[model samples]
Target: MRALIALGGNAMTGPDGSAAPEAQDVAVAAAMEHVADLVAAGVDVVLTHGNGPQVGNLLVKNELAASVVPPVPLDWCGAQTQATIGFLIMDSLERALAVRGVRRQVATVVTRTRVDSEDPGFSRPSKPIGRYLPENEAKVLVEHGESWERRGDKGWRRVVASPEPLEILDAPAIIELAKAGYVVVGAGGGGVPVVRDADGTLRGVEAVVDKDLAAT
Candidate 1:
């Protein structure tokens, strides 16, 4: 049987509520133990992950460093985090497979997901992102055209329109990879949401997608 495992950032959370690299490694290693057992039982695995927290922190870093360097766009930021985290997951899983005497090729695909251009979310950004900010800071950003929303007792956070995923642009490739007995990792950060322009060319949008919802 084939399996698609959707991993979340919380899966890598440390005891102190942080998801540092070391923490992620430990967490992934533990997950690998379970996955290895499944592989031994003859299940082909396809792993997709959500890097919301990591990508949010990355955006915050870029924003904080804007004065010293130009801030990267959200699409680029998403791609960067996917590559970074995908590598860690692929490598860790590969090592686990190796220790279990299973030989499998692991690949990370830079995937894109299509969303409707007219998605209502565009007009009303509600997807929380980046780090939490003080109410005053959030107010300033919102006043300057950024979107912010309250997070219960925590401060507000920047939000972007999270549209529904229309299609996985790389689904065929992912399926082929899984059929070939390779562990494929893709769809990180909701697959770098994009839309085809009138010219039939693809361009990324300034929004994120829900990984779990998109995965379906």
Candidate 2:
């Protein structure tokens, strides 16, 4: 049977965790080892992952170096995490299959998810993202047009409206890869949010998509 796996962010935050990219690759390997079991059992697996922690890390870096370099928008951050996590996962999946004497290719595609431009979430902006910050720090981001929302009892976090994913822009590529017997990893971080123009052209929006909602 073919399986579409929605891998969560926990895989990247494993016990051996460090912020280093190499460490991330190791984490990905660890996660893939479990998936390897299914592959050994004749399952064709496709992976989509979460970037909650990874994107938060990038935001911290951007905040720390705001004066030195331009800050990356939320949508761009999502894309970066997609590529970053996809790289490690794809490499690790390749090794996992090889160890089982299963020779199959793995591919990662940077995916886009379409949402309605009139989404009410855009005005409300209530999806928590990036690192949780103290109230004072959140005020700083708010001053610059980034707002905070209550995150349970912990603290406030930057929130972006997580609109529904209407379509996956990379569906064709993902379908083709899976049909060709490759383990396809796509739609990370829900997908970089895109909105369709009146003329039907799509452009990246400054928001993050919920990973699970995209899977739905």
Inter-residue clash pairs, candidate 1: none
Q: Using Cα atoms with residue i matched to residue i, what is each candidate's TM-score against the true structure?
A: 0.88, 0.88
Where does candidate 1 stray beyond 4 Å? 134-156
What would the per-residue lDDT of candidate 2 be over residues 1-216, giving only the tens digit for each residue?
A: 988888777668756545567667777888899998898898989899998878878989876665566677888899999998888887888888898998988899999999999999988887676777777766666666666786877888887888888999898999998999888999998999999999989998878787898987
Shift of residue 30 alpha carbon in model 1, Å:
1.6
lDDT of each: 0.81, 0.84
Q: Write the per-residue lDDT of candidate 1 for residues 1-216, one digit (tens) a residue.
A: 888888887776666757677887788778877877787778988888888768867777765665466666677878887888888878888888889898887889989999999999998988777888778756655654567789988888888988999999998998898888788888887799898999999998789888988788
Q: Candidate 2 deviates by what RMSD?
A: 2.5
Q: In model 2, which runs have C-alpha deviations exceeding 4 angstroms?
A: 16-22, 132-145, 148-156
